[model samples]
Target: MYVPVSLLFFFIGTALFVYYKTQPGLLPETVTGDQVFPYFIVNGLPAGFTGLLIAAIFAAGMSTVSTSINSSATVVLTDFFNVTSHSEADEKRKMNILHATSVILGALGVGVGLAMMSVKSALDAWWSMAAIFSGGMLGLFFLGYIARGIKGSYAFVGVICGVLLIAWMSLSRQTVFHNYLTIVLGTLVIFTVGMLLAIAGSRLKKGN
Candidate 1:
């Protein structure tokens, strides 16, 4: 599945590149990533294929939105509500909470979407923001899985450090690496720092 999808993307990208090279005057210098697909659909595709492409785009968007809502609701229920509760809640109550959480999240997502309507490059902005958000999460997961014997306290510290580093890297727009690589750098920082702290703490405890 992954390979096929990747090949599809490669072909599509190559086609787009060829189109742009052949018709440089069609698009402005300030054209964004979001404009590429719509332009292709409107200009490149025939009448018969255009509608199909539009439907496919809508379906893909709907699929992503549905998946995001479902995942958010699951996380809220399992991680936040379930963990905080002392006993098993009533099924009806749980369902209500889940629904409420989904509604709130949907509203928040809409608000954010509206706020970002004027963004120059939606793809770039989305990737950058996603990298920042995923940094601490992926870092902690890596720390736990790879760094055996790391204490929870050290792990927490590592997450904090990783988040701070990510913030600095993002704010400074450091050219040391590309924006997408920030997440990888953040994860490495968290794992390295957490492991070092854990080992140092263990040694200090043994000395005492």
Candidate 2:
């Protein structure tokens, strides 16, 4: 799946690049990344093909949304609910919670989609938002996976520090780092501080 998807994107990107290079006048001067595919379809493709492309795009979006909702529901059910509880009542309650979670997530997704309608550049906005949201999360995951001695307390501190750093970078008007580097910076800060704190605590414990 991954390989095929990667190759598909590669070919599509190559085609887009070649098209832009050969026919630079086709795109408007103020056009954005998000508008490229739609612009191409509207201007280049025949009416029948355009409809098909639009339908395919809609189907892909629906597929992604359904998959996300299902995954979210499953995670909420499995992680929060007591799977060991075999009673029918417990099962019903868990099922209720799962459905509720799915509904809430779907609503949130809709809200976000509406909000993004106001954004000028969807691609940039998405990348920036993803970085902000996943920065601390991915940091903690990497720290836990790579570092052997990091305890929960150290991890907690690291998460706090990472969140604070990302917040500062995001909110500061004079920030020097590019938007794309935000996640990388946050992950590094968390892992480095978490590991150092863990090592220090270990040494202090041995000395004591």
Candidate 3:
């Protein structure tokens, strides 16, 4: 990340970030957002740096929206339809359904994002709330991954627990941990509950 030392520090900082992001995902989730943005801004960056930051912000939002739409649509098409479509003749129909789903979801995300802008900006507690409930999701994957016992019917129970855990964490106003840590704690709790359910399921199966 060294530069000619002759160039302004702002330019050097910009160069270094572009170089860094090019190399794998650089630091963990926290550091990645931090280092580059601050370095360029505090050092009195050029106009281009401001442009880049704005672009990066919008790009992040767009990518998030796109991914959400695509994922939701995929779940509806694959899991929901795969259950009942049992014939070769239905494959073509399913493909059409998937195409329709993708378009509809994409449109919905754009529409909702625009519509919700008023709500998003009006709230002061959004960032705190963001951190408070951030970690509920990682729990689902943890149970669905390491603990082989959690599967099938018991999986839904675990998911419900994850949602409830987030709700409890958010409403309690107990911001003991930062947003990132909140996610880890929430995930851990949900994973434990899910595992217990899976274990009980195993016991019932063995008794039967």
Clashing pairs in 3: 131-179, 135-183
TM-score of each: 0.82, 0.78, 0.48
Candidate 1 lDDT over residue span 1-208, tens digit each: 8689879976887788788989898767776576786787887779989999889889998899889998999899999989999999999998998899889989998998997888877756766676677779988988888876788899999988998888777757556877767888898889889999988998999999
Task: Check candidate 2 and list the clashing pairs.
Answer: none
**lDDT digits (tens) for residues 13-52 of candidate 3:** 5777776667645534554433555554544468887779
- Candidate 1: where are CA atoms >4 Å away? 1-7, 28-32, 136-146, 171-181
Clashing pairs in 1: none
Best by lDDT: 1
Query: Candidate 3 at residue 174, lDDT?
Result: 72
Task: Using lDDT as the measure, name the better of candidate 2 and candidate 3.
Answer: 2
> Over the stretch 13-117, how does candidate 2's per-residue lDDT look in tens digits?
678878987989888877666677678889889999999999999999999999999998988777656565565446678789888999999999989999999
Off by over 4 Å in 3: 1-75, 89-95, 119-137, 141-146, 167-181, 199-208
Each model's C-alpha lDDT? 0.84, 0.83, 0.66
> What lDDT would candidate 1 get against the real structure?
0.84
